[model samples]
Target: MTVSRFYSPQSIAEATAILRQQSGCQVLAGGTDLLVQMRNGVKQPEYIVDIKEIPGIRDVTLTNQGLTLGAAAPAQSVTERPDIAAAYPGLVEAIDMIGSTQIQGRCSVGGNLCNASPAADTVPALIAVGAVCHVVGGEGVRQVRVEDFNTGPGENCLKRDELLISLFIPRPGVGSADAYLRFTPRTEMDIAVVGAGVSLSLDPMGTVSAARVAIGAAAPTALLVEEAAAAIIGTTLEESALAALAAAAGAAASPISDKRGSAGYRTKVVGVMARRAAQIACDRAQQRQRRAH
Candidate 1:
């Protein structure tokens, strides 16, 4: 029997060294996913490196670049920032929907992301807002786009000795807004069967100038559907445009059958969620425009 080694590294350098030197070391951010995996025999790390005490990783900072969410910060803390909630309501909605209130207290967005569940709520929202992740390791720092971060379910792009330090999401500009929606078996405390996130920028004339559409629980990984965005751009998202958007989004999904939902059901629901989420985003964008005036 191997005894699990626990480590509470107070700095990135210390954590990186341990990860590089140890044969099996896993990061312990919120331990939301780590503990579950350990119990299920999915992961058996010899070393558990607690990084919550790492100076910069637990602090959320707003900047000209946008809102920087420290990887170690709790999901609940993200909603407490009024400025961030106002700027990126869709992200806040997604972050807030992660598990229940108690789970939110301990789960970090970074953990949800790195856990790489196809049903993770935040992935689509992050992709819709063009979020970027800052990763640190023995080789130093690098950035990865949120859309490109996860390779598949229970898998991520993180290499050995590497961990996400922070996530950066752009601040919504004037006439810009976003929204997220998910279909679940239950009203609350349920995994998303089909999730959609939409972000858009509208011109003064009410036509979309820029747009992003992303879907989760509909593929091996959450995906940014550029064609769906193209379907609604340059229009007020009329029925014709929305129909196209739905069709394109539906076409992008390649889900597998599961107890939560079947592949066909997930595909159809993604189209409906995509259209609804886009409409909500469009409405929010118009509201932002009015607020700006």
Candidate 2:
């Protein structure tokens, strides 16, 4: 058995320094994914840098401008904040599905995103809401859109010396809302066969003024489906628009055949999931509009 050295860093600079010095060091936020991979020999790291000890890494802040979610914040912590839940219900729903109750206590959204799994439920939702990743490194801090963060399966844009700090999301408009839905073989603890997330803003006349559509488990990385969003942008989410959105979603997906489902099946099902999620988002947008008045 290979014994790895563990270091708990209390500051971002300290953590980044450790990451820069170590060649094969793994950052541990929640350890839900890392520990499992370590045990299975999927990842063999010589050093483990625990960033959970960093100040404010687990804090959740919400303001009028939007939200600043700590990268290491646990799923349970995010779900417990009523302000966060109300402001981004679709994101909350995705976080809630991270794992079971026990796992939720330790699973962090940052870890989920860093894991870079194509089926990560939160990635699609994050992309739909236009979330941006806050990263720090030797060169200083920089921001990357959630949709552009992940490069491929189990890979991301972060450099060896970089660390993700938090995520920022702009405040939704009065008539804006979002929704997320995923298909899995089991009800819980199973990878998504397909995941769809949609966010839309409605005008006073109920026309969709803006929209974003994203999907997971259909490619090497979670995808932002601009064509799907374009399909519903000028309409009131009517059946004709939904049908077009679905078709666009199906067209954008490039899944592969596997045990859980086949490529053709995933392609077709992603359309259904995207359509349903859009309907849910539209309904939520209407509700937001009613409440704002």
Candidate 3:
């Protein structure tokens, strides 16, 4: 057995320097995914750069701007924050549903994002809320929208030398809320066949003023369904509006059939999930409206 060399860096610069010198070095935020891949022979890394000890990567901070979620921040850490839970419940739901109860404490959003799995629950949710990824490297820091972060399954826009620092989500406006839902073969420990997330802002007149709809596991990457979002933007999510949203969602998905579900089935089911998620978001938006008055 070849022993994998491990380095735990306290600073971002130090970490990047190590990565710059090494080839095929794996960044360990939460080892939940990395360890599994390694054991399964899917990944072979000579060096492991552990960033959980880094100052900014493990913290969950709530500010007036929004949540500054460290890339290494555990799902449990994010879920435990009452402010984050209250602010982005849809994100909280996605983060919390990563794995089993015990695994959540060790699963980081960064790991989930970096894994770039098509079925990742958090990707669609992140897109729905317009989160940005802050990545750092020897070259410098750069920001990317979460929606554009993933290029394909098991691939992302990150260069080998770069590391994600944190995720930033702007504070939702008043009368705004979000929701996430996914269909899986099993309730727990099963990958999603399809996932849908919706975030919407309601005007005082109960019309959807702003909205975002994202679908996951139905394409090469998590897809931002602009047409689906447009369907409900100027109207309440009535059945007619929802029907249009579902139609758009179905048209946008390009899934491949597998043991979990057929391509056609996934396409149809994702539309349903999108409509359900939209309804949940709209309901929550109304609740937010009530709370503000």
Candidate 4:
């Protein structure tokens, strides 16, 4: 197998035009996943349109709505953003845990989501933060919630010629914090057996105002447990509430037995991770609230 044709586009318009004109053309961002798949003969694209050279695709900006992370922005870039780390620690933590420093240098969040791996670390964090994906195609642009982005394992709603433009993460309020946690056989360089991220917001009276909990690796795509979140809203987190949320989180998982972990273990760990992450996020949220006062 050989990559015979490579097209490097200088602009998004050129990339979109190339994609529309070429058949079997795979859009290449960082090539961290695509190159490996191609080399392993898992995928063989007739044309590779390299989008890394396109300008303005790597910007990370803080906006009134929240944060807009460009599709081509490297993982290292996302992990190092002080604003992102301070505002959305779960996302930063997840980004830090992805691959190694070298791999992070070459991996883009868009590429990670577009790859649509069941265990992708960033998905859970994104889902917890209520992130939306901006996609562009010949039909123009549209936004899809991160929760709805992945259709299933290794599959997403993106069309053949559509490209992910950026990710939009809503800003957490002043009294909010987020945490991401994952369990694996070894630390670093290993895919998660089960991963969870939680974002919690406290009201002025020290009660829970809003919450979002998302789990990964325990489901075909990132799973949002709304019922678990509802269990904690409108009150300070209690042990019993946390337990209920954990159980709900575990019950929502639909995992399969695989070499990395069993479905039972995945379910149990998803609960543990979700509970601990929620507690951690609550503590952090309290600290942020105190600091703001």
Which of the two candidates, 1 or 2, achieves a greater TM-score against the reference?
2
Estimate the lDDT of model 1: 0.92
Maximum-TM-score candidate: 2
Candidate 3, superposed: residue stretches over 4 Å from native: none
Name the regions of candidate 1 deviating beyond 4 angstroms: 1-3
- Candidate with more favorable, higher lDDT: 2 or 3: 2
Tens-digit lDDT string for candidate 1 (1-293): 24378899888888888888887788889988888888888888888889999998878888766899899899988888888888899999999998889988889999899999999999999999999999998888999999999999989999898989999988888999999999987989889999999999999999999999999999999999999999999999999999999999999999999878789999999999999999999999999899889
Tens-digit per-residue lDDT, 66-173, candidate 2:
988899999899898898889899999998999899999999999999999999999999999999999999999999999999999999999999999999999999
lDDT of each: 0.92, 0.94, 0.92, 0.90
**Candidate 3 local lDDT, 135-179, one digit each (tens):** 998889999999999999999998878899999999998899999
RMSD of each: 1.3, 0.8, 1.0, 1.1
TM for every model, in the order presented, reads: 0.97, 0.98, 0.98, 0.97
Model 1, position 238: C-alpha lDDT score: 95
TM-score of 2: 0.98
Span of ten consecutive residues with least summed lDDT in model 3:
1-10
What residue pairs clash in candidate 2, if any at all? none
